[model samples]
Target chain A: MDLYSKEVMKHFRKPQNVGKIKNADGIGKVGNLRCGDIMYLYIKVAKDKKGKEIINDIKFETYGCTVAIANTSLLTTMVKGKTIEEAMKIKKDDLVKKFGGVPFIKIHCSLLAVDALAEAIYDYFKKIGRPISKELEERHEAAEKIGEELKKHHGGLFKVEEELHKEYEK
Target chain B: MQKRIYPHTTTRTENQRYFNRERRFLFGVGVYLDYAATTPVDPRVLKRMMPYFSKKFGNTMSLHSFGQEAKADLEESREEVANFIGAKLEEIIFTGSATESNNLALKGIALARRSSSGGGRHIVISQIEHPCIMESAKWLESQGFEITRMAVDKFGRINPEDINKAIKKETILVSIIHASNEIGTIQPIVEIGKICKEKGVYFHTDSSQSLGKIPIDVNLMNIDLLTASSHKMYGPKGAGLLYIRKGTKIEPILHGGGQESGLRSSTVNVAAILGFAEACRISKKEIKKEAERLQKLRDKLIRGILTRVPNSHLNGHPKMRLPNNANFWFEFIEGESIIIQLDLLGVAGSTGSACSSIKLEPSHVLLAIGLKHEQAHGSLRLSLGKWTTEKEINYVLKVLPGIIKNLRKISPFKA
Candidate 1:
């Protein structure tokens, strides 16, 4: 009957790599004061002798709840050896699903963790002077699509209101 | 290291169970766990109240036949309430709530003494007294009356000696809550009353959390004044009783056409009063068995949480606490976060005092019991009541540990 799975609790109780990484290739910090949850992720990404983009190390310092902590910890593990593009595509729903399912009200906490992970990957990309990854581009396109939908829904009313107001003034 | 899978299968099922259970629990499909806030109106009480709202509906003060019948019902309710508390019938005064009754008992007594005897301008109250009494004491202080707030132990219980030492010749009244709404710690009002009586000072207790849940013998306890609400005891919300011992004069707070022997002057709420009386009668007959049943459930809840949840501790007195009360604090987890998760799981409980839940500040009662800010913030109160069942308690036990564990994982404060 308990809401959380034993595995979620296990990871939560003993989080892997829970501190900061020094001399990291990518350092990402994400937060907004109004949101009340924040995370700082430090990742070491480099090519191994095999010339593969292997994650040498990952650590995070997060200010959030068990879900947030577990989500961030799981995120670090999930993205450790993946190419930067793969890491950037990680979604909030993915993080929540990994935790078995967060309460709907607290799905935001998981989102905060996912957002931090993306920021860290972006920071890594910036440090290397690379253009935005395909994942980042996809994220931007998704946001634009949402904005376009909103505009299409509401763009016409403003012009009509302005014309009507001018006629009333006249 | 093996790549941690993007979709952890076991974790998904756990989260599913947690969220699904929480959802099922909240929509009344889950156990109705919150009983102390207010109980479902007993069917008998509803039956008793029905006549007053319909054919028998009349103003008690009116001289007509219909009015006389209504007046008779009101007087009978007054007598029933008085008898329940072992007080004289004339001493009982009706109010809108226990909060109002508390205000009348403290303010009326203080103002009356200040105006009449021109002495005894000091009042002593326990640190854990309901805000109704505590705030009234503060108001009295602003009016030049000295107030002494005695401290309680970590169990949220005041010692008799502390109360005795706090008392002085200038102390006009000593007001304490018979049972705390948060931790459910029952104070030794009898001992406090004895000390006040010995010192020739009036003693009042806010029994809002105790009446109908426990036996209260005002005469045996030497209680000069007592306050309780009908809603707390399975009656309607808009009715309450203030028992002022006969010959203990207090100035009326509300002045109008003389009613309640000029102590309180308001049109009677006939149906509610009748309901209140009926509730009292039912509680008087069933409280002992009800208390035992609730205690078993409360004990199960406490033991289950402590055993299953790491770093969880009980919040109130072990034995002296209310039979229906169980409060716990799980470290590193936010109480609201856990409550939300529990809500998803379908359990209905509270983080702290229902009255203080809106404010972000930790409960004052929790603070009084010596909980640090962080510990207080992690608190949850589970109060059992008439409808609480063994199955519900077991379900809560099964569900809560996983919620706490899942929440602990995401908590920034987790050690």
Candidate 2:
């Protein structure tokens, strides 16, 4: 039950760029406190040479265990220099690779970070009045499904909407 | 208290130096606040048992002088445990563990009742009982004996009224934990035992957490069967006891040489039993003073955590908890994170949520007390012990707030 890798401890000990981004172009949040993990991904979007949006700045705030916080920290660092499409390409496995590997029980933390990143990119697209693509919509749905599955498995006490509202107040 | 904040932007070296400086103040004791998990064997108890391991070792059942000597010491050890709980010499049956004792109590009673009497094959137990009791109940259910799990209140107290209602014509026994190891809530066993007595049903209590820490009188509580563990009370781990009142019929769970009056069959663990008796004697002798000292520390810890860490709360009953136990829920931060961070800071503790279990369920005790699954996952249990010093408590109180604040800063959820 050594659930944490050395990388997880390292990132958690020195997590980079924590806290919310003010007036960020896109913000995505996932997880509930009752479920033992909550991740918020904030991205500042900028355009490169061919008008492709790049994730110029990224940050995250999380409340979770070592893997959850580490994956979020690593997620921010992994996606900061990538294009919005590239950031969306970051999957659960990529974060697991960065952590060496997480225990099976903690795979959900990596999934949460990937979900938040996808949702943040979705926010960026919606803000620019672009029609959401089918793949992006499916990724968002799948990510939402992970949260739902977690709640069903873990037996959450607060409704998702209510939990999200409480986080906003904080 | 002035709010002390460490900026998140501080260098790793600065944080390390700060923790090292705090650690140096504590003289390398490495604060052991997880006493509820298990305790180091007291030196006195170990010294008393060392002779039994090699010097005077002999089979208690053998028909020889060597055996007679061992038998004498075994009976003496049993008498010590019996006197500690105000039970008769024949009442205590030594077993391997509290888990084993619980199994014997529940299953043994259930089987005996089913075979001998046509009355009831049902049993009653509180939801807050340890997993051993719950798992034993589940096994009994599979064996065709109905089990009624009584619910506890928000403070983890099982209502006697609920117990009275739950008892039925077919009910054979009722088992409750005298004190919860997780949350430290003390049940009103005397009142429950009285109700059981009026109904003529047997009452069993798992007093593993309360026996050495608090006073127990089987006569006053009307407890017919009780389970106690030695490891929890600063003795060796391999020894436990099940106290069966006279005339209580329980079928033998293990069949062999018929040791322990045919209830538990195994060659007695002489060394461990001797150590257990020594632990019981010491606990009985010093219980009052130790209890008072721990209560002061527990109260100090509860108040410090609650006031210094905003959104933190004490779990279980405010006044009815164990003298050495303090459990708290720190909102918006996971319990595992708190425990791990505290460990890194030289403080050892436990989370109500068990990460190593298959299902990873939050503490059943916390869930039984009406905590949301999220809140349950954020709970911490810090148990004081005989060796816990005021300086260790002070160091923890000072350092823990900073850890919580840092964790909250990175947490996406806020309370």
Candidate 3:
């Protein structure tokens, strides 16, 4: 399948915010080593004058296919200036739509971006000892489960998507 | 031939500017380094095949003068191909493709032995064989034959002793690739063949990639059955040869018309066979000198890439490999990205990742050779051919390091 969309290709050719954020507030890493795709998301959370937490700066480092790299690039662009709450609401579908659309086979890549964002936000909340909501808690758990699943299938027989699908179904 | 032209609406200056912009977007003169995949038919072979299309077109089975002429050409071509491989003329059986020839060898031998009084039910093949052989082994498994896939070393070279250990009292045949298309590692066919011979089991080698690039004497190698594809050695596609030793008994895969001495039933593609014979003749004459030239180029490419690119490695055996092939694994960046970037520079090559499948999987060959999934996914195969020039190699050397650096810049792997 033509897994990479033209928009994805554009982002891949010129990815933005593709490094670590020093002394970052939160870090989220997701991937299957067997699938040869890994993405590390770094976010620097800042409290504005209103005392609202915002993702002031975000960066990513990815080793994967065109779709995986592009999704990370798009996710970073998406959450850079948004409040932590707003970033939590950014769904995988939104990421796919922002990049025109990815191939059906590559929807998991968009999900990876969402998972990284959720995990990062969860990390931020834990660091500050803030009360995490039920929704945020659920997202964090799902992202954590994905991380565990990826590690479990480090040298898996099934494809990455199949393993992830089974985990989501569970 | 018909000549055609399109009406142009742009002025000369506009046309020039447009072409310049287009050229900037496009890669340089298309450099094809995927010869292990296939190659363009040699013009000389094409020239010899022209008359057979219409002028001398006849069914070899017919009794007319036209049939006699076609028959004469077919026999002569068979003799040429046989001479090229040091086999007798009658030992060659023409098939549609290399894949077909492999099926005929593997299935044909297995089935033939199944019906025999003393024939066994076990077969042995290397883990790094082409898909055709692998699939054939799978089929044999369903047909109640015991199949053992021998493991290879890190260099993708299978040990002859491994074959010896894998062989059993019921082992009927052993088939392995003469040279690997992905990693370019040449198997120890002579030693393995001797093993199979000593064990009283038939030996088959798929020489689709190695036939013309290296020397092969079927009798000397003790190869009972050998497969060769025409297109891999500058011959036309749609024609391949299976060399069945004169006394080897094998069942026919196809069942009609009684062509190819009833071993293969379809009417022969006369023109394609002629082209294949011409290719074989030329390859036999040019192989030694050509191997020397391509070996120098292959070494230069391997050395340049390994030395220039950090964390880069050679995939196959260092010295005992095909003279035309050089495969590598670059750390950090995946192979698909490298291929796409190389395509932009007009360099055509291949990767070990089976990304084209329904599920993205690294090459089984690479995995069998002990490369981690991540390393296997980042593999590249640059296979040179007769048309590959030193200038093209230099161009690749000039542009490749820059592409690797750019890809590594965006990679998540720190190394």
Alpha-carbon local distance difference test for all models: 0.76, 0.85, 0.84
lDDT of 1 by residue, B123-163 (tens): 88888877788888889899998998888999998999998
Q: For every candidate, what share of the true interface contacts is present?
A: 0.09, 0.48, 0.43
lDDT of 3 by residue, B1-415 (tens): 0011112525666655544443334324777898998988876799899999889999898899998899899999999999998999899999999999999999999999999998899999989999999999998999899999999999999999999999999999999999998999999999999999999899999999999999999988999999999999989999999999988989999999999989999988999999999999888878888898899889999999999888899999999999999999987677877777787678888898634334677888999999877678788999998777677888999999998888777765542
Candidate 2: regions farther than 4 A off = A1-3, A32-35, A49-52, A129-135, A145-170, B1-28, B64-67, B354-358
Q: Give candidate 1 regions above 4 Å deviation.
A: A1-170, B1-28, B353-356
Give the Cα error of residue A110 in candidate 2, in Å: 2.0
- Candidates 1 and 3 compared: the better one by lDDT is 3
- Give the higher-TM-score candidate: 2 or 3: 2
Q: Please, what are the lDDT tens digits per residue for candidate 2 over residues B83-167?
A: 9999999999999999999999999998888888475888999999999999999988998889999999899998899999999
The positional error of residue B49 in candidate 3, measured at the CA in angstroms, is: 3.3
Q: Which one wins on TM-score?
A: 2
TM-score of chain A for the candidates in order shown: 0.71, 0.79, 0.81
The candidate that achieves the highest lDDT relative to the unseen native structure:
2
Give every prediction's interface RMSD: 16.4, 4.3, 7.0
DockQ of 2: 0.36
Candidate 2 CAPRI grade: acceptable
After aligning candidate 2 to the native by TM-score, how far in Å is the CA of A169 from where it should be?
Answer: 12
Candidate 1 vs 3: which has more TM-score: 3
